[model samples]
Target: MSVRQLLYLAPIAAVLLASSSVVNGQDGVAEELVVLTDLAGLGRDENSVTYFKASNAGAYERFGESIALSADGTTLAVGAIFEDSSATGVGGDQADFSAPNAGAVYIFTRTGSNWSQQAYIKASNTGASDRFGLSVALSHDGDTLAVGALGEDSAATGINGDQHDNSIDNAGAAYIFTRENRTWSQQAYIKASNTGRIEEGDQFGYDVVLNGNGDTLAVSAISEDSAATGVGGEQDDDSAAEIGAVYVYSRDGADWSQQAYLKPRSFSTEMLIGGILFGFAIGMDESGNTLAISGFNEETNRGSIYVFERAGSDWFEQARLVASNPEIGDGLGSAIAVSADGNTIAAGAFDEDSALVGIVPSDQGIDDQRTDDAIGAAYVFVRRGDTWSQQAFIKPTNTQVNQHFGWTLALSLDGDTLAVGAHFENGGSTGINGDQRDTSAQDAGAAYVYSRSGTTWTPRAYVKASNTFARAEFGSSLALNDDGTVLAVGAPREADGAAGINGNQAADSAAESGAVYIY
Candidate 1:
């Protein structure tokens, strides 16, 4: 067992061992929940294989080829990508031989000790290179699946009965597959009004997310026109490559149509500032109306997150987010996690000021110094009626400069609970109490949990994987299940800790694997 697995399983084991019920003769351990150590294998795949052990100590069953967990956790949907052998006239000469990847999706259900596949749905005319199943999202009930085929020939005509022909370029398309009477059907196929380009890494339709009722779907085009074109034309920011965007779609009953296109008003300016540009859709909310788009490499390498809201039936730009008091050179807001309600948001400023704490005062009196870039922090936001305001700024209780890269943030609904990952902290530095962050051998990964009580929030628990080390892996990604009871922290390149002992090994000398923490 690895340290990652032990951290998660130990709690459940302790709880079970205290009870006197014999559990399947497997150490009489009545498993409340079994936390899997590894979520993905080595390879650049974004989707994870879904698994579940229905009963305590039951066999682990692979639930689907590709699974997306719904926000409610009651249902899960599986998706697959299928290639269409014949797709001619749709996209000829312009379609490069090396440029198409297609895909499809499957749905599943969990009841008692049985996990079964529920539905199989595919995009029409899916073919090799379409990469359809590349991105998939499930509604809260698992009845709807949104799949993206960014490689589809956008120039084809009469889609969803519209006479408009698809545009050339990397015109991407998204399909909404709905389940009714236990039968699944393709409800609609959506394409951008202007999809003409052959950018290899355009990565169109890279991410897809759905609202609770499946009434809303947000699709991202990292390579889409950045100018926010109401009138069609390629608009360049002059500062960045491939301006990113999120499109919102709404469904009434069973009919769906494009409703809004969202991009930051001065997003072009934000990208062009430092001559280095970065943009992509890393995460989104349930409604798809609310999106969390990330951009770094901008001025000072400090990143920013943009939140878009759907007003009634139309999606529009809601607010722009950066470090509340952005540090001049601190690269904050690089990684983000937004709750389904959009009311709560967490942005990671992995490079914010940490060393100035001793020099600066408390939250009661704001710090005035403009140049403090040692430690990192995460910003939390709460939405008021029409706009959003900063609610709290968070840092590890014991944080140090260059060590606590408070790099990832995860917020639970109601914004009451938060989980932070500081991949670089060495125990014994500041409030961090492990030898992991030591110069010669930073030993392990640590995560902090905070809870909001009344108006003030307090750090409730600090967790560390026993055998972790410096550079074992950057604890860069984090996810919190709806209730915040289950926290999945990704240490993508972690090493296998002591055998049976499940703790730390010698620093810098271990194999790489990823660990997921369940609290």
Candidate 2:
């Protein structure tokens, strides 16, 4: 049996939804949670995946806001969006908290079963409130990395533009870094071609996705207001308010350039108040030939996803997808996952107000009623050739108001294993296979794992916090290893000030200090 040794500083409790026929001969049809530690690796246990403390973790650091694991699962990246350090490049003075909300990313590598922090990264400009590490992505080999700063204020547009200029307000930018011989350096600094200026608040790099090979990337500008549709459309058009747009780029010989600008054909007049998007629905396939971009129709209050395909040097829209049974305010595509081959997609509607429980038939549609408020739902879609169809409607076995079950999603390589996070879930369940019906804790959060055999889906595991405390919301962000054998969950609101294993779980000194767990 494999052992799972972890250094968990965050206190948390909660259980999320998952369904399926019993597999692996375990209770709840889920694999048992195993923990083991090596004598040599103590502070950061050998059996533990790396334990990240940001070298100088403090309250409101917001570490674990974003996380990514290399395809091989040897490397991990964690983002602390509220990190306050003026350090530039990597491994600089982390003790300097001169820049508030400047943000930072930590890189950790595993040798055998032991893990260690290797680098502390920050934006080149390192301006205050830039939020450089709010979003992050890693290449399959873990050599290429992308960091997003939605709060960056540079007016420059396109690749390698001027970095010193900060006339623009919250235009945002994305930085690419490559590793060679265990050394890292910035490759390029990217901004939207239609970069927003002062008062625009485009937030260009709100989300970033890198293809496995690290040659292609997709960046989302959450508040872009262009009414233009299709690739290479007019960039100056601001007729639409908060009309979102995505920028695609490719790398050749260390140089990067914009490939295409993407927007769904079913456009939105404006992004609504609940339109705050996470890294959920925006992604690229293994080769970056296929992509999924999501947006909400303000008029209909319904979210939709745009799937695109690349041909030679151009990109073409493949399909626009929505929930099988669409309902106003379902919040479909709030978070989404695409298979490595881009043939399978799981879209989460966190605000979906469904009263249903467990898995529903795929051929038929959902009940489409506002039976529960913010109960949440997720849909699975399969592609046969160029056509796509919904395969299953999933819900948690135990549902509660404002559980927000589909807040985040991760799909394993080859698309068989799937994990979902309900960070708002209130269940007070602890550890693996525990009772999920207990709802005493508020915002304790939970993670659920499911496996697929042929076309049938079944529950694989139920994961909860080891400390089982409220407000930790353990699964706020998730990353799965290539084959899905390893899972990493992040919680950005842990109050424990202590670091490392067996920390002071009762310490409430640090509020909003984050932590990550490997299972």
Candidate 3:
């Protein structure tokens, strides 16, 4: 019998079919031994990378400080929290450097593996040091966008209130933008409903989240300092400092109204000082009926996640989740994601000090493990009727201290896939599943992907920046498409200053220029 070779290629990765082996980085360097067989479809190409930066990129802009992806992954929004552009609204002047740390958001659209800049966005009333892009969110279809300016000084209250008022200092504000066809226009300028009575330093837009339909929004004010608890509580009381709060808003036609104001209950308030973050992370299901808000209790140095469900026009707390064997400083709720159905939730304890390795069974909270300090861990929980329970515990195959494995995470629409980021990982490896043992590149960053089959979760891929560099923070932020087939990884500290995709990535010319990677 004659010997023969069989060949196969993923339909989505057909462009790379010419090359049997996968290459890493845009430098045209084959830094890995990975081949197409290992990839095997799902529209994933570990070897592929599309790099992006601000069109008017300057050093320390932190172009990828925040990021969001449309459900299909064709549209992307990148926030340059330190971007200096003083431009107001969409498609304004990006060259002027009058406004320092003003922040800006850049939108991009992809077609057949090619990405193009769609718009450059700024707050409606641009101001210096506003940090307008500190946080950003996009709707499923990319028709609606929200930008947070945690340093915004306006004391304006309600929707589309006065944006020119600079009376309040750091009261924070959020902006809503809607797209018609390919053009985008500002829809509203939102401030905390208690803006005037709250004084200043609330940081209302510290974090923001938008549902798939683009009609619902949840914004976090990490340092609201309210003694009030529960929804629609007394906002006038600011005695309890740093209590934090989350605001919900709903859109009808083109109008937006505040739906609810949520504050923590029995939360540790004394230690809320020293920059402790409460209600620092927020997540919402596609339908906007489910919400998960994570808060860190500074007193215990531990964290808790609060779940809420919506009924008619009211929102009520469902449960307060804590790690089964949570140790002090676990930081379990730094990052979180809720599935489309609102049944599956993944929470990240980026500060977790677990020394456990590999894919362990569901719920390992009983294990009193610690050696790799700040190695990080993630817990998956599934809801049944009105009950919620942990389903799986995840750690990387190679566990190392200071890895921060679960710093950020995302879930597919169906809740079948998950991606976790470790921006502090010190691996020099490139492409997927490379050498994680190397600690040469400090904080070069890496990402991990996993898939679920029924109740079992399995490791899928180990991802890294094509041009991995020390202190790049490659996984600082992450976003996944509806099907989890596409991913966007932000490396805010990436040194390459070049703008647009496929630019020179090997140079360390632009310090802190930041970059985004598409896979």
Candidate 4:
């Protein structure tokens, strides 16, 4: 039942070996593929594996659903939004279950080759169905952490405000935690500043990101229903239903303040009638001066990404990017990432149908394939001074329909390296460089690495979990260290009995418990 697969790219001498299972690429071709074994069978040469689960986690706890890594690769934050922990705050008892779905986050520290749990975090005002830790982000130094609770029903706003208020349903909120020495404490609480009377269903903290220095934070409310155009606009406007909004906050010394409220400038009666989830995805540069916001349902689901730049204390819209050959239902901005320096950006179109491989010309028409749906693609954009240009079109070598290749993305500090996740990829082969041709493993998922030289990008590696199983969703979430040397892939639906580092992955041992792998 276990096999080691080896794939060799002859020209590069880069050998990819899998543990439990082996899948070979095309025969006689320079690209000789190798598939490795399962997580329990990985060799010493393979990356060390660490499995994480809540101490009292149940079958549907989903411990590794969201993951964030420090720039130095020494610290990690994992989110378990479905964790039914009744305990509130840090280091509380984990067995209490009075509050169902209150959610929890786990912090881990790595020393040498061993990783250990450092802290268990929960909302200061933990309540039933709050769903804290739905999304997590760590500062470059790993000292500051941001946790989002998209299902939180609080009606509070601003920093450290009242969290007990639940007059609004699913209004959402985010928390900021700071670590000094090795102890962590709640630093601030954030909510939409412009949330007027009808604040229900805003889902303010659906996604969050922090700048490298942790001085700036960006949060998205994908269900924000305001027609506001810019900073401090009329937030009470309900004309735009689910148009979405992004909020930017800046820290001064120890205090954080709402800096700007961002919305697309194309907002109009027609747009308000058509816009949907404009801020579904967001990314910010290290300086916190540049930002990318995606409206995946814009233009009849063709999707668009908006770029914004900061000047003094104001943020202004810089550019609105769309696929050169825009097609309906392409979902071009479903996922996005920006480099540390704000010079590079990547946008994913998970529903793209083009079969073209590697870099495609920006002028290429959308007529490449009409039948191949959801083949997926990612586009890289480079900034020269104030002008931005599309630099590359990237795809996996084994691109196939419905793989959702760009469902998630992570970029290195320099933006020269990128990791793309295809959470719906169907390949029975497990581990790295496995046979991507097989479709037996439904939703097993895969990740791809690409390196950039000048303006060209080359495929570097194909990654997957050692214990591939149907619906494990190995590449559902991804995070890279500062230099892209360390990558963490999350399989939130993994059904393994494994609890902690290198445990047994017995078939059907645990269902939907989730797992995380470091490579």
Which scores greater on TM-score, model 1 or model 4? Answer: 4
lDDT of 4 by residue, 75-189 (tens): 8888877788788889998888788878888888878767788899999888888778777888999999998887787778888788888888778888999999999988888
lDDT order of candidates, best first? Answer: 3, 4, 2, 1
Q: How many clashing pairs per prediction, in order?
A: 44, 9, 0, 20
Tell me the TM-score of each prediction against the true structure.
0.61, 0.88, 0.90, 0.90
Higher-lDDT candidate among 2 and 3?
Answer: 3
Q: How far off is residue 76 in model 1, in Å? A: 5.7
Local lDDT at 258 for model 2: 95
- In model 2, where do residues sit more than 4 Å from their true spots? 1-51, 266-280, 297-299, 363-365, 500-506
- lDDT for each residue of candidate 3 in 326-410, tens digit (9 for 90 to 100): 7777777778889999999998887677565545654453463674388888888899999999888887656667877887787
Give per-residue CA lDDT, model 1, range 40-144, as digits (tens). Answer: 221111122122211101011111112355554434443323222232222222122232334444454545423454554555655555656545666767678
lDDT of 2: 0.72
Taking the tens digit of each residue's C-alpha lDDT, what string does model 2 give over 1-519?
000010011111111222334323211212232232121232222233333445578899877778888987778888888889998987778889899989988888878766677788888889898988877889999999999898899899999899988988889899999889888889999999988747767878877899989999999887787767777788787766666788999999899999998865544334432332322248677989988876644335467777889998799889877787777776677666788999998877777776555565643335445644777777788899999888877776566778777867788768887888788888787655466667888988777777778997766556666555688777777887787767777777866787643355567778887777665
All candidates' lDDT scores?
0.48, 0.72, 0.77, 0.75
Pick by lDDT: 1 or 4, better one: 4
Model 3 alpha-carbon miss at residue 516, Å: 0.5
